[model samples]
Target: MSDPNDWDFFVGLGLALSSNLFIGSSFIIKKKALLTLQQYGVRAGAGGHGYLRQWLWWAGLITMGVGESANFVAYAFAPAAVVTPLGALSIVITAILSSKYLNERLNILGKIGCILCILGSTVILLHVPKSEEVENFEDFIIKIQNFGFISYVFILIILNIYIAFYYGPAHGKDNLIVYIILCSTIGSLTVMSCKGLGLALKDTIYRKKILTTMILQVSTTLTTSVS
Candidate 1:
């Protein structure tokens, strides 16, 4: 296992940037589609998933899927640290699109804040370490079984359960941040599962051991389902 060459690195970067663009645009488009649904159909907050019937919503979803696919491939060739910070660009893009297309207002302070975020992301990207290729499934398993990682996963589970049973009913409806916290916490686990699955698939393709890869694939699937 070796570091990706310069060409692979740049290709991944380009894919990530493209994903940011598509994802950002999808946000605005989806919002518009939702608004359209709200005008003639039940709101999503009222237990309606009627947005599914809208072609615009479907288009937005397809765009988002494309973006995620690009992001998935990007991770194969680049470090998560490098690719993850680049996601801030999606926020910047969303803000700009929301203002232009959705008529959402951005105050001067907000503009300044967005600029600062971009600058911070750029600095992080510049200094981020490259990804080290894992040699095999055994090494990946060892890494996953680290005490610190296990503890972190345990804490996340406990917190997620607590939030679902206690904080969610009390404050989730009134507070947007509650759902954001839930998504962020659960998303960490999901991302880990996806990364493992991606690596396993890559290894399986390289090694051509179908039986072992099948087992790894099943385990990864179960991990994702459990999470």
Candidate 2:
């Protein structure tokens, strides 16, 4: 990864925020489409594929794709620590939009949850490093190979396996946290992999270094798969 200057950091921040906006709105669009589809066809939960026929659903899907692409690109320009925490903003956006567009009421708990998300993002933002630590893909590789990072990933994988297989089948439906933990653990690995891949892509584009990019891409893919 190149050293991200102030302009690059701000651009990354903008991309992250824009991604959240698109992703958050996509939930509402897709939900509204599903609700509308239910009036004419079977519910998707009952194995209906009727949503494919709805333009709103397609629009939402495309919007989500754009958001995800933006997020991936943001990793190239900013540290993952900075970009990842900002994802919480999506929850706040979704909650607000749900109340306004979906007729969903934000109870006290939901309101509290939104407030907490904002506060958490704010705290992380206030404390995040002004500059990224890794100046290049080689540095990223070294960091990922560190003992602490390896140990953490190992623990995450074990916890995910235990929760997904042992506890999930029994309590996942009733207890959301089990699945949340599973997803969060897996998502952490995915995000890190994404960051490496993003850096490789940027380096390839700007530096025209295909061989290093290939190696970095393969390394990231293998790391995520291992996790």
Candidate 3:
């Protein structure tokens, strides 16, 4: 039989590609739904969650969820270096969908840009290094408990809380940048936790079972929620 690791690598590649397709299509669907909502109700930037009532929006959200789930599974089986860059496929997909469905004109320059994105993504995929050596779940716990990482997580948590509670209600409504900053801040931490969680789960399933993996997954999930 072929090596199990090789099997996992191919599986992850397939899942990542599938995720890109679904997520890319979801963007167009959601945008259409948003446009429809804008015509019928208040805009989202003005405290309107009316998009929730749009069936297209819900469909798009469901599609996106499936994509994200595939992405999570891909992470469990492949290195971040391999899986992350594959997300560029979604950009290409979205561009194509936008031109087709939204009647958005793709200028010559835009076409070149899309081609360049595809070329870059192809190069990255072709040259991506193998997945890193698997480590014990205890090693992850030690890394997470390190003083520097702990302090970083603490700071992110405090900042997120401050922004959500104090600054959000006051300036977030008018200042679009504030919301972007808030989301970006939390997003960084969430990405880190997800990487760690993926590795832990991967090790637990494929290697020796470790109780710490489950614990780490739960804790990281909670941290993601907080973020």
What's the lDDT for all of these models?
0.78, 0.84, 0.80
Residues 168-202 of candidate 3 have per-residue lDDT tens digits of 88999799988898877776666556667777777
The numbered model that scores best in lDDT is: 2
TM-score of 3: 0.70
Query: What TM-score does each of the candidates earn?
Result: 0.76, 0.86, 0.70
**lDDT rank order:** 2, 3, 1
Q: Rank the candidates by TM-score, best first.
A: 2, 1, 3
Q: Residue 73 lDDT in model 3?
A: 75
Clash counts per candidate, in order, are: 0, 1, 0
lDDT for each residue of candidate 1 in 104-189, tens digit (9 for 90 to 100): 99999989988987998789767765445543555667777899989998999999999989999999999999989998888777
- Measured with C-alpha atoms, the lDDT of residue 215 in candidate 2 is 49
Q: Across residues 1-227, which tens digit of lDDT does each residue of candidate 2 receive?
A: 66547767878888998999999988999999999999999999999999998999999999998998898889888788889989989889999999999989988998999999899888987888767887567777889889999999899878888887899999998999888888778888888888888877787788877744454766577555744
Steric clash pairs (candidate 2)? 1-136
